[model samples]
Target chain A: MIKQLFRSCIFLLVLNAALSSCSNNGVVKESSTADKMGRFPEKGDMIMLTDRPPQLETPLNIFQQDITPNDYFFVRWHLSQILTKIDIDTFRLYIGGAVDKPIAISMKDLKSKYPADSVIALAICSGNSRSTFSPRVPSGQWGNGAMGNAKWKGVKLKTILEAAGIKKGAIEVTFQGMDKGPLPDIPVFVKSLSIDHALDGEVLIAYEMNGQDIPMLNGYPLKLVVPGWYATYWVGSLNTIKVLTDTFKGFWMTKAYQVVNNAEANESPDSPAKVTVPVSHIKLNSIFILPEPHQPVAYGQPCHVEGLAFNDGTGIKKVEVSVDSGKNWMETTLNPEISKYSWRRWKYEWVPKTIGINHLMVRATDNNGFTQTSKQWNRGGYAKGFIEQLDVKVK
Target chain B: MLKKTQFIFIATLCCLFLVLHSCTQQKQPDIAKPADENPNTFTVKGSVREIFINHDEPDFPEAEGKEIFTSTCTMCHTLRYISIQPNFPHKTWEAEVNKMITKFHAPIDSVRAGKIVNYLVTIKGVKQ
Candidate 1:
């Protein structure tokens, strides 16, 4: 709602200030979101960042279960024109180009052809915590709720590629969905993955999320699930799968959703790094489950300070919690996981002795040895896996 | 070493940052949050056929030049895009206005665009 209001604000000012700036068409070098209005509704406890094509985010506590509820799952669609209803009887999945033989398989044929395979994985937008960027980024000023973990049930993408018969020289596989933008000038939402990545067993064409036909906003008929990768690569409302012979250069892939092509995938807003790359596997991060910021904890009482930590499927090795503004640190206990790709739930016990504002923080290290940082800032507002700090008032 | 006024300015800025950038807004207890379903089999229920998102009207509905803004600028997108952001300064608003006109090819002519920018700077932008 606030975004629309900004859209209509007449051009009322002339460029007049001398502020530090980024090179993105002379936009000032701040990544902070200018959030005047609060959350808009996306459905079932989820808040929408944008309304037209419906981009939604889950609340922090929605992480109550490692497996997010299907009804509350967040939805994101780049295109404005989405097919609300599908004629399942006539729906066909067309697999064409760079294959031994082009094939169009119906929903029924897909179900009967391959046994359903399932995996629990997180689908995260690359800009999950974009709003928290200090200087403020221009769009999608979202908090961390832009991600969700779910048990997705579908056939492995490898199954379909195998049935199509591998033809040599195929380099990538492209996917298109049933949604489109308002104008033809706006590019179609198409994304392509490397052929090797496509054939990887981790990729799935999920028709069901958390034991139900995927919600309409969450992609009704199908979604391409790339475990550990950002949701941009996870094509929603999947329709066509086209194999390619060369590296894919689609706008969604080549242009948008890229991070600084560096080891840390981070760069400065004032001076951007050269050579950007598509934002790939998520970085390690943790969040507070209990004692939410400003939530009151009883003084001199036992309290469970808890939250979830996750990586791009690499297991969380250790989680450390600090209650006195990182003055004293304690190791948190992590619950045994049901799925490797899912987040690990962690908890720490705190007995607050004093009554005041108590800062609680949690940091995690993944098996990959990537430790969470105190602050993570990127130019396009992406991949912030900083240690989460919450201020709890112990009364 | 910063001057006293400079310290206050920076401190105010920091406080503002904390207020605007804090993760998770005030909790709403009444929102009905659903629980996770069994991660196994499935049965179809009701479906979402279509969505017509009802956006809120602009905050400055009664402000000057609101008519020109709604008539011209609401063509491509709703007003939510602008309203959702933090308070932008005059220059940022100018750049943003110019961006929409030059980059996005928004149909607002220079005169109207200038008026819109003026209104934004006067009402929504940082006070000089």
Candidate 2:
């Protein structure tokens, strides 16, 4: 009996080591302890802003791929209590309020009942490059990694609402996710869309992202995909949809995510814009993918510069790159459009003449003939579509 | 003799499983709480797995109002939010504090809000 027990102890130790190593496999932690807050499960090494309600930013290099992988997608949540676990068997998306009939649809029903639809869209945060804003901003302090393009597949919100029989008086529809706040007074993260926009057939209740189930941090089970609009309206872990007759004056719509009601969404710090509206369609913007910040380019050699240009699916008319600040602009070759809502990749071939630091900039012009402004500022640091410049050293 | 041997084999299997499972469990931090609060089992029911984040608190410089800053601000988010921010003017930091209280409805009294702003400006402040 003693000999058998000793053998069991040895077996247990070996088993423990194997299981522990397996769990730690592929766990990549950033070298700088100060920059890396924590590594969440089901995600690669992300720039973790906050842990409680994770605000993770994807590394910039991950944008090289047109379709952002589910594992490397950026995550942003407002409330502290985010849903960590979900049961698809019991989960029900309740549609109620100004509808003729309230219906509770299960995950299985949602996938099987509705005609499945998919759209390649770019879901970007309104304050994506908030850290790069001049004079700086207090929130998130995110680099250009808070956006991702993915093929979202699921049912359309219009199909669900129509089946539920929308009442005539319904003017607006409110969406609420499973996330909640620590305090009852702290308003839940609720966003509203006009009844017309909700039924546009473009808005989707996404179940699969990039051909697979979305990572939990990126909103598993269900996520609202509002193409061409800022991601603030993309409610994650979505469970409730309510139609209302009156305009929804939720805090998220009115108090937060509001930008100046101007062409450029610009406002002076000294004289902040009095008139503000909820941020809607994304603005024209482009970002460099190659020769990362401070990454050197070969002098007297043809260097290939690549980047992504995206806007509110307005269709990119052209993308231009300037090697010497904004003195001269060369039109970049845009790759074939994947979809109207997806970001278009652009590339430029440049031969560096100077051997020292050179300023490289990129700007995008949309189908509406709107070019990105060189300098744009807003107090909220929202809707950052200003021209982006990267200083590359030539050796 | 056959029954005793069978019992020992089953007991050994149980022991090995328990030891392996315990080794794979994620280590929880003192400040951060996993969504599944059950200490006995970190596993959640259904297809989705429970997410665990190892939140190591950021170090803050010793200054006045550090206590009030850490206590009041950390109620909603971690200190990395502040750590990631570039130095802003006192006015900017003050506005941020007020925005948190007024806009987000963070339960911070005026006195506490002032101290928190002072602490942020003291460490992460700039003359702008």
Candidate 3:
């Protein structure tokens, strides 16, 4: 009996040490934490960049479908103290500041009192592909998964503000959410838009996403969906709307998320641009979906190459693919547009002739005749609108 | 009597195996279940259930001032923020640490802040 007990103790210790080493060895990869897959509540396994102010990126394969599911939607929040629990019954969206008759509307009131509006729009992070930028910037080093397309259901911002009776001198509209900073001096996360953009019927205060209540992590009760703009403006767990007569200069707007005042928002590292403006409007970009990086393709087999092309609500005129290192270009068939603001899917049938590695590139042209440029760089790594290239090996 | 002792020993070994497996699986930080729910699982509330993210800190390389770096930086965010960043110049790391102190009001003293910057520069700094 004594001999048996000693043997069992030795066996258990060995097992424990082996398992601990396995987990420790897994962290040997560069950026192991970023590469580590995590499953948050109500979310699928995603690339977790941080956990405190949860920043989760959707897997790239989820974008193959036209509509990104709410469970796999990308999440990005700025403030550290996020809303974990809430009493939806007592929640009220307060509308005041530069209004003749300020009013507080409940969730029930928001749905019943105002007309319901729905739109299928794409909300992309301003720094979505910041990792891919050459001379990499030191922000959220995300790939092309920091964006998602969803069917947002809510009342129009115009309708909500008009119901509040906007004063005559209202110049800009500011939005605030329940999220707060850790320190009192740390500025509360807020964003502003011009009065004209706020009153635009397209801007929505979404309560439901993809046919259900927005996930708590994605912003439970309310989310401001600024269609055609970067997701930075789409505040989550939104509670307050203020109409300011003067220009609203907040830390988020005037200081952070500012890009160069140019078409591509490009700048040099040695000499940064002096003038900068708040980042808005998704830039023209396209990404290859099929034949994922390093995926093998059979020689002489007609592979169905697929991708997505999108701009700032401007309809895509065409998406061209180059299989021969941009020496030749072929136009791909664009699927029917879901909405003016939704991403347009494009497909191409290509037969690989070469047996070695073949470089594939994709670029999009919008209705305004603006074709994606081959090179772009910025200090903040915002607005990755350059041409995308993917390489695949043919067996 | 010998058979009974053997049976008890086997039972204890099985329980040890189970406990060891669970210990390896629990790499993520412990999070409490929602109110009035099972300890092991989350309550399914329609399609959009509440979510709790995993806060597993990465194993950073050991160096001088690593303790200060980990404690000061993680006061607001996970060390993954630093793990995900590509190698930057010393000036960039200095600016980043100073920004935390000045802009975001991180309560790191100047001397410790310099030490933290030195640690970051040692691990992930590149020449401009």
Candidate 4:
């Protein structure tokens, strides 16, 4: 017991030091002794992005392992009040609106009626790295951890639409989750996608994640898995899927999560907020794996600089690493995975010959000739695709 | 003999630290406290059913507007939503405050909302 207490003492000291630095910058406050008692069962390194509606972020280091673990999957919800206890037996997904007829399909019937399929795909928040935006936009101040990849098992969304019997003039499909707000004035959290995007055969109304029933926190029972797209459209605890003839103008799609409609999708904060487009498709982005931001390296020792690169549907064609503060870059070897929708891991070995602070940069190019830009600017901080810089010191 | 004494002193210090840390952890949820000063009473530690809102020590810059800001805004969400953001201009804060009223239906009246906006602008807004 004494030895165990001694270990705990050392932990407290280290945590105190970490807390001092973090609390000041508001990186993460050291949860007081009181804070510790109330913390939910979360991965030690996972971060609480926000409390109400409960958004969580995965630590970037965990991404080094391909196929992020299911428990560590980031959680996000638009509504503060959620259905905690769901009776799967009685729970039926309602499909209606602009269809031949509205049908309430039971969970068992929905699965047994259609063949099940699995795909490893990434689900990223449109505002995944909103905190990094300058002139800081205020929403979920998340880092890169607001994204995850999972092998989702479910029936094709097209199959469900077919069962509902789509009529002519149905242009888009709107989705509503089992989350609600307290007041009637507060709009229902709903999002819609173009009918073509909805029926692409890849969209899965997922029941299981990583070969098991999805966790309640990460959208249990059912979730809309739109591979290669941002998670805003991938509604959690999804219960309602409605087809529409007109474009969706819900608060979620119209007034929020919008990027400037220009090609670059950037605008000054002072600029007129006009002509916006719904955030779609994951952009060509990359992140550092070994020697994370502010980490150190040894001079004259060989070390591999590794990271991951991903884009919406267009597969990653090239990923280049820069040693000289992004002055120039060289290509890295890509480790391809089974699914094209997943992020590809890249590696490049380098022997640090110079001493002092060194900057490492990474940029990726997707198959569609879309390469990352040096800077990405927007008010909403949606779909940021800027080249990443990792500063390290040679000791 | 001097080295032995030094080791004993270090051991005693560690033990004291352990006790202090355990006290802070306060494993059992205290059910009895109801005083306004007791933050624990506001947030019982043990229930998932409960929604507890806690703030960091020295959460924000102290000013006259903080009291109003805390009581009104935090009813729906945590103050960290505002504190965590990088400082923007009053133009941004004005739109944000208006958005709270118009979009989220924040209960603060126009006058109180204006005061809240002024507070945000003065404290966390762009430095003049």
- Which candidate number has the best lDDT? 3
Kindly state the fnat score of candidate 3.
Answer: 0.39
Write model 3 residue lDDT over A1-395, tens digit each, in one string.
Answer: 77877888788878877877765555545434434666676777788787778899998889898999998999898877887667777889999999988999999899999999999999999999999999888889889999999999999999999999999999999999999887788888999999999998999999999999888889888999999999999999999999999999888999899999999888988799999999999999999889777789999999999999998998899999999999999999999999999999999999999999999999999999999988899999999999998998999
Off by over 4 Å in 1: A1-42, B1-73, B89-128
Give the per-residue lDDT of model 2 (tens digit) for A85-184: 7777889999999999999999899999999999999999999999888867678888899999999999999999999999999999999999999777
Cα error, candidate 2, residue A90 (Å)? 0.9
Which candidate wins on TM-score? 3
lDDT of 2 at A28: 35
Which residue pairs clash within candidate 2? none
lDDT of candidates 1 onward, in order: 0.73, 0.86, 0.88, 0.77
Could you say which candidate leads in DockQ? 3
- In model 2, which runs have C-alpha deviations exceeding 4 angstroms? A1-34, B1-48
User: Which 10 residues in a row give candidate 2 chain A its minimum summed lDDT?
Assistant: A26-35
Please tell me how candidate 4 rates in CAPRI terms. incorrect
- What is the fnat of model 4 with respect to the true interface contacts? 0.15
lDDT of 4 by residue, A221-335 (tens): 7899899889888888789999999988888888777788765567776674678888887777898878776678899999789988888878988999999998888999999
Candidate 3 lDDT by residue in tens digits, B22-114: 877687343332223422122345433344544667679999999999988887888878988989999999999998888777898999999
Error of 2 at A20 (Å): 25
- DockQ of all candidate complexes: 0.06, 0.26, 0.32, 0.17
Q: How do the residues B38-88 of candidate 2 rate in per-residue lDDT, one tens digit apiece? A: 231224556556665555567788999999999887787777778778898
